[model samples]
Target: MKKLLKVLSILIFISAAAFTIQFYFNKTHPKIQVELKDNALSCNLKYSGLEGSVDFTKDEKNNYYIAYKDRIQVIGKNGKSCDIMKDPVLDIHSIDYSKDNLYYSSGDKIYRYNLKQGKNTVLLKNIPNYGDYKDSLLRINGDCIYISIGSATNSAVVGDDNKWVKENFYAHDVTPEDITLGGINFGKYRRGAFQSYNTRSLKGQIVPKHFPGNASVITYDINNGNSETFAWGIRNINGMDFTSTNKLICSVGGMENRGSRPVVGDTDYIYEIKKGIWYGWPDYSGGDPVISPKFKSVKGSPLQFVLDNHPSTNPPAPLYQHKNVGTLGSIAVDSSGNLKSKDCIFFYDNSDNMIYSSRGAGSPLAEIELGKNSIISSMKICDESLMILDEKEGYLYSIKRGKVNAGTEIGRNIYLYLLLTVILSIILILKNQNS
Candidate 1:
């Protein structure tokens, strides 16, 4: 009986020892936490107030020039500020400068101001009426411009009076002229004329024209006095830039009326624009099919439509996607060559009020938060500094990269030390027990 009891005690001890060893191994495996370099510079928003879109240019002397809605401001390397344009301009969408002059866009007009003479000239006018809405301009090389025209109405079904119209009205099959049957505005409206579709054509026979409020990119010519459609079917595209490879890139908004809780994870995209390519609007957004009953597939089945006629063998997806994040204004490239090997695209997120850097080869990278300030318009690289346009306060902010904070490094080191300590404690406990 004494020998049997001894054997039982040995077995119990071994089981406990084995459990301790396994726990220590799991605890000691190091976990890596991501850290970002802190932004060095901060903003002083006292000078300008409630500004709109902005653009930056460097003079021959390498001084920075910023054009804001209602004013043209210039900042020197020494942080000196000047009111370059004494008079105000309206809806200044974008600005670009050459060695001797500055060019800007306001609504449907493009203007050039001579720096030497301080005189402004209307280079192009009456390009197109945006129609009870203001448009944003993007410059494409020289003598060409891109503009985004957004949809005018909120989301609603064709012939329905609800706010926010879906992009694919054909799937709904109710022409813009068709009247709603049971809604609040029922029995008093015509067939098919939904809020987004043009009232002039509702037979479903004509190619749908551009949505009055849907965002579109228009290419305008200054030398030849002509303009053409560069791309269309965008829903309020605010951020636009070009990649290092000269591909036109844009950040667009997602479907607005899908749900009241802001449609979590509906998928907003960053697209590389190609000529004559229609991003699925009214039918799809973010590679997902928007279903409606109007289009025929099979009886008593949901009608589905895709961007392409057939399942795309090679559809271009977003270089990056931010679910439920609202992107405002424009993206800035690191033109100073500081991050030559990294992705050149730096976009500001309006939803989180952050600045995110994309890895050049189309990989998901880390996002850096820009504190609490809201940047509404654009960003420009000046020398080694990043100048952000703050639309609400009408100021240009200069931001620089600085040393990694001591707290961040210390936190990482402590985490490592804790894991090591836990492992050593377990080993010591086992050794004592064995003795």
Candidate 2:
């Protein structure tokens, strides 16, 4: 028994030592490789080990500024990182830079960080922050900042799909325009549209619109410090950018299968953001009624329109539609003319880790695969290179104009830590049984 205990102690010590070394190595040198080619565009690994990075933007001098959940940093062209803001906000989702200011969104607030003065000011606040889709995305155009706020509930009817209701009981989806309830309730709770899970609504109930509403896009004029709803009724826009011609483009996430009004076979969309337009939600997807047989789940009843009368039953269709793309993410328009087109568009799909580019809406070209186990959390075009952030692996890759090359690996496999852990667990179990 003494010898057995001795052996176990040695094994445990060795395992701890190995784990420490590997953890340090992974932090210092992350693994990265690339072998992506799509018609004269060659993707390459630029930077790795971007811990906690969700979004990044480039400044006028072409320096990279990265947003990490609570803080932001600037990576100089010399490859050195300098902290710009430390623990200033929570849940940082998107970031943009203009003139001497760094603009970013976190929680229910948008902030502006003056670089020269080293001061951070809240530009907008009290944005709808509840529900599964609270993170907001922002893009700056001239003196205006366009912000996209996601819905408080899936399909506007709060149900079991909402996990935040236990904390914020009154949290529910709000509209940007006055809407009349369709006299429909969802689930046993009998919750009505735009009402809390425990609340009920009357048939033909008039729900007033509120500023800075959920599931809508609003514009903030930097000059006047005023915000106005740019568009409404859009479900969730994961990414948005402006084309060279100054047209706003967005990647809209489709309805999921877990909501009270479950919708299946719904297609994601690429849209040109138009002012005051109702890009259908809860009723229409891709400009088609949810009551259509295509959206019905096999094990569930047919889907119904959550709203009786939509602002427009026939909303404008998306510029492009993607079926089974799986949670569309960050989008970018090539304003630099790198792809030799007027405004080449690129968007990422988190489900498959594929980046698809198209000359226009209908001409989606072959996708560029970045390898396995990659979750592209954010993407942008900077300095004629497409910068992709792989949040799962803490890697940042750049796709530029180059010759196609085969995939290559550098550094050790980080998963070896997991293997060591499993082995240690087995040894402990065996020792306990023998004792």
Candidate 3:
């Protein structure tokens, strides 16, 4: 009995002490992994934040391109690069190549940079960016250039007489047909002011033919320089891509924590964007119609189609609905067979200090969980390795599989956990022997 008590006390004391040390002192360092909950993926820092949105180019000699705001640098594996163009335009959100020309987005314009001719041309300009939703992601597939535009305001419920709307629409030469063309309502889509949750009423609303109210995916035919809306009714979708099925998959970041961004528990999602369809925004969240929580109305629209802009047709469902993702960076498709999925979508949420990869449905799997409040500005996959830009440090990191670093969840000092286990085992052994 005495030996048993002694062993129990020793184990308890040792466990308590080790746990305290792990909790109070253990610090997370740079480690990469297949999943945030998994072991370390080998990590190595490469470039600075100056190397902007990472993408590979058609040019075989220069495999990758990074937009550094001031210039586009084409780089090789060993750090050799040449300036494609110097700050040709500031605020470049994304950069890519289509045949002979390079495509990049700066604010509302999709600038066509001719690689062969070495000249700059504004492919499409005067796009709308209302609220804090102006992170344009440019993707070029074949001859068409796709641009994902974020909303101008949170809900964009400006009254019919909003001067900004009139000016912006007129400047862009949007016609009544264009507004009504996508079955989109203009003038006022929302019934109430920019407050919390309000009951949606599409009745008695007036509008022009075309409504450029919120988020939209547009395509510019590089051959004709003519652009058209691909999809609409999205809030802020910075990370979107086309899958092998010729369909779209985008990470839609809804209602952020800010003024008028109603915290109705609306989370983030991976949207499968379809043509001529409105993926819910403002009045809906996570593929279901939702009454803004501010409305204080417990009773709301049905889970699926809450407030219908188009009652006849249902909005496309989310590919994967994530829980409250913020500051979503540009998305990349993983074709690196080394990864579990042949074609998986990966994105970073600066708000969560985590990177995510699409895993069918449910929650997007956390690929790499970063620490020290490291903000991931951009990410790109190269061969067996994944490269990431840490905005806070302005450093880029390359990650591949490595031995899992245990005790990250319990604490960073994995040795402590091991030592504690060993101590407990020895105590048990001694106690048994004594008995």
Candidate 4:
């Protein structure tokens, strides 16, 4: 009986020791599979407290000029910093550098700042406001600047307009044709006092006979002072980049309100934009047309049509599904111009409050979780490393690709093996004592 009890105790001890050793190893092991390079450039957050969007431009000298809100900050190669312009007239949103000057935009006005003289010249002004213009995500493609304009309203207009019309007098079941075009026009009334307030509210209220909302891609010519809509029907796209195939890829946001529901499962889209092509907005989201009792529609209404309504005419699907992950901020392409584990798009996931990398091809590769206080505003590829801007701290973080440190990995493995051996020895001694 005594011998049997000793054997039982030894077996129990071995099992417990093995579990403990395994648990400790699991906790310490680095889960990241890809290696990161050691010698990489990193930047500390030099400035803070700027509202609005920010962008960076690199000069031939390799100096980085950062444009934020209303100022331009130049960071020297030696990590020295200087604000070239202070209390500037324009509210700068995006900036780019040419050979001798820096170009930026405030509203529809584009300005060029001479790096040597610090003089500001308006390159273009009073560029038409087409409701959904987001200056920060503006792109200077070839000879023109491409800006996205989103819809002005939550959804398409619906219902009758007579203020005096008794609620009961209006038949709840009005025919679709009777109310389709003559709904209550909310146009500029929704556009309140402030410009941002007006834009975020008013622009998409009335459906223009030709272009629905003023939402469009306005292309501005830097050499010739002319601008026009390159494409239309985008609700509120924040990210745009060109693929290796030279196809203009954009991340398009979805409609705000559908029926009485406030954006439940609307799927945002990534489109390979073609000239003059209209992506369905205010009409459909994620191949599903929005239906509302308030709005009347004709037979060919996007809502009335099913996914199979026009098999060949389906709206482009999103490369990935972020059902309610909130807004997708920026997208970058890899060397091959494809989105893969290496060629991935890094986006700020507001839902998870983290930076997630989707390898434009397969599953998500990695995630860098941030604290509650940290908010990532923008991301850019700087040489071999990836730089992310933390808006809250005004800090820039650089990430590089390299192998796991040999010393660190080997040390971890040694510790794990030693722990396992010690546990096994303890069990063996217990067993021998029982025998």
Candidate 5:
């Protein structure tokens, strides 16, 4: 009887010890499975317990500024943090740091928060935010701040696919340039492109260009305060970054199968952005027209071109196509030379919870796996360490070369958990043998 009590005490002690270590002391040491390359990397859990954090940026002083839905906070190396700005009304989307200012988008406005003066001033306003793809991403490249605005609806029409119709009935897609519609109405309301859900259009009806319109990358000059469309017809660019060669690259999400103009077998893509170029959307996917039989719905009729004419019928093709990747987000170029090449880029797959390192190829050289439950919202390479924010797990993981931590901490807790269980089983077996 006393042997049984002794065994129980030992098991209870082991359980308590493991719980304390996992919750308090275990600073998750993760691993990177670099299957393609022979690169030795170290992954570490830099920060944890951030639930609502959306995006983050680092300054020259190593201070990490993280943006949440309601506030933005600056955290130091010592794990201490304080809110730099707070607003309950702000639904902050993306963030970028340049010089001494941090720029971010919230709702329909972009604000620049100056670090020296501790003030945030509105940089731009009236961005279209009343649609399905409303995340406005901004990146600072030299004197140009490139901002991406998403289309208001799927394939230009505000049909039953839009859940925002109940709240904003009159909201629909806007054009960056004047476009002549084909006058094809969708759904029972017979709504057309560039109009409200209840409105219709005639053939050759012109939709004038609106400033800061959807489906475009707008470049705002910091010195001159001038903004112009850099490129148009980008369906929904969730990720944007400049390569080491000063070329802009974006990860664009393709059309889904759940819209009025449902496009089957659509795949997300990465594109090299060129100034004054139009990457096709609504009427095209990956530079191919939607009228192609490949885009036809599985059970429904074929898709027809919605535009009477296009700015450029021959748009540039995608640099890389991510087959079966649901939505790609947060692209980062490795300018720090930590990877094999300076031009190597890393992007997140929101559906698969994996990060891939690619050099503009159809297949990735290596992939960073964060399991199935992780939702990597944003990632960047800073100080030679790749910093990734897992929004679902509420942790910021860092990956570097062999210069930092000695071992990988990926699944380290599970190893300990299993080890304790094995020890308990052995003790129980020996106790039974003696009895």
Candidate 6:
């Protein structure tokens, strides 16, 4: 009996210790984060006014290249600005400055513009423009180019009030089973309008169709010009990145302005893209099952017409939830020595106009405020600070640590740590006695 009691004591001790550690992490993280957030240094910026929807890329020589409207502009450190476009490229969304070429994505294709040769080659074509979300979010990995494409319809259903439904109403006959993301959990996602259409155009009577070559993210090979789907079912992953381990992580936008859905409190998400996993769009939001208005006992179109017929499985939860962040611009994993770890992700919300640094669940955030109504279009880490582009304000600003704010995060953190430790220790002691 004594031996059994001792064994139980040991087991309880270990389990309680583990639980307490996790509890401490969950508790102390936010408190420390609040302190750090409160004491966060205001943005220190070297401002340069730019024009249009400016996208930036830095070359090896540390020169800043900006693509806007109809030209490619290069701004030198000595305050000289020059246009470098051989031809005016309309609607320049993304640009990458490599040693051999200047790669840019516009319209329905990616162009590899050879600098010395002065030639343009079509790397990938037939890309989908799903409403306005098809901005061709682009980035250059080692030997390839990655781009994100959004869905074709709102909430993957033809609602009575949607504008797209009124226009392309005949194009889609979609169900949940059409998603087919090729994973363990296939039943969770309702594929959108882009996934429903057979082609960009309709030939005969429009029925439900799967748009060919329509994927969320695609990789373009520079050598042979072959492109492949990196992942799918991201809904509208506006901004994405290849991490240090080359794994894709992206920021997904929530559905808003849909005639049938709620708009104001919609939640956006940032996720690490595990290939073939669906990040619950149209069917789910903010790790919770999206309650379609039609699914309610309303005896209406959404309920009586669609919900009973849909067969999609459950969708996956997000890495982090950003409440009220409607349109996310760009996501960069910060390696700068700012907070605790280097893998923390810093993402900008164009709608919110704030830069948030987070590492999934139970991690602290270091938020830097920008001016109100300022749209933080894109960001890049340079010299341990963020080179932020406020496209609406037409200014390139720098955000970095100045002086550590008034109260100390360190001293309070230590006190809380000890307090939690003592509380847990006392609880464990009581538990042992009862056992």
- The parts of candidate 2 lying over 4 Å away from their true place are 1-31, 297-301, 361-363, 403-435
Instruction: State each model's CA lDDT, in order.
Output: 0.52, 0.80, 0.59, 0.53, 0.81, 0.59
Q: Candidate 1: where is the Cα deviation over 4 Å?
A: 1-55, 76-80, 86-89, 126-133, 140-143, 154-201, 207-214, 222-225, 258-265, 292-315, 335-337, 360-363, 392-435
RMSD of 4: 12.2
Over 117-193, each residue of candidate 4 has an lDDT whose tens digit, in order, gives 97988866644332323353566666777766554333433212312124323211111111122122233333211
CA error at residue 158 for candidate 3, angstroms = 3.9
lDDT of prediction 4: 0.53
Clashes of 2: 0
> What is the RMSD of candidate 2?
10.0
lDDT of 5: 0.81
Per-residue lDDT for 93-200 in model 1, tens only? 677766477777777677778989999888767543243224555655556666665533322233343323354333322111112222111122322223333232
Q: Write the per-residue lDDT of candidate 6 for residues 1-435, one digit (tens) a residue.
A: 665566567656765766666567445332221112435443443445674755787776666788786677777776677877746656678888677688887877778777678687777776765353557878887878777777655555434444554555454323212432211111124322323322231222223323323326777777677776666556677676655677677888876645333333466788777655545555565545545441332122232112222233566667887765566768777654453256678887666456678777675354765667577667776666667776776777655567532333443355566566667756765666687
- Candidate 5 has which clashing residue pairs, if any? 29-409, 29-410, 30-409, 30-410
Candidate maximizing lDDT: 5
RMSD of each: 15.2, 10.0, 10.5, 12.2, 4.5, 18.4
Off by over 4 Å in 5: 1-24, 27-39, 298-301, 403-435
Question: Lowest summed lDDT over 10 consecutive residues: which window, candidate 6?
Answer: 179-188
Instruction: Write the residue-wise lDDT of candidate 3 on 246-266 in tens digits.
Output: 567777886543332233456
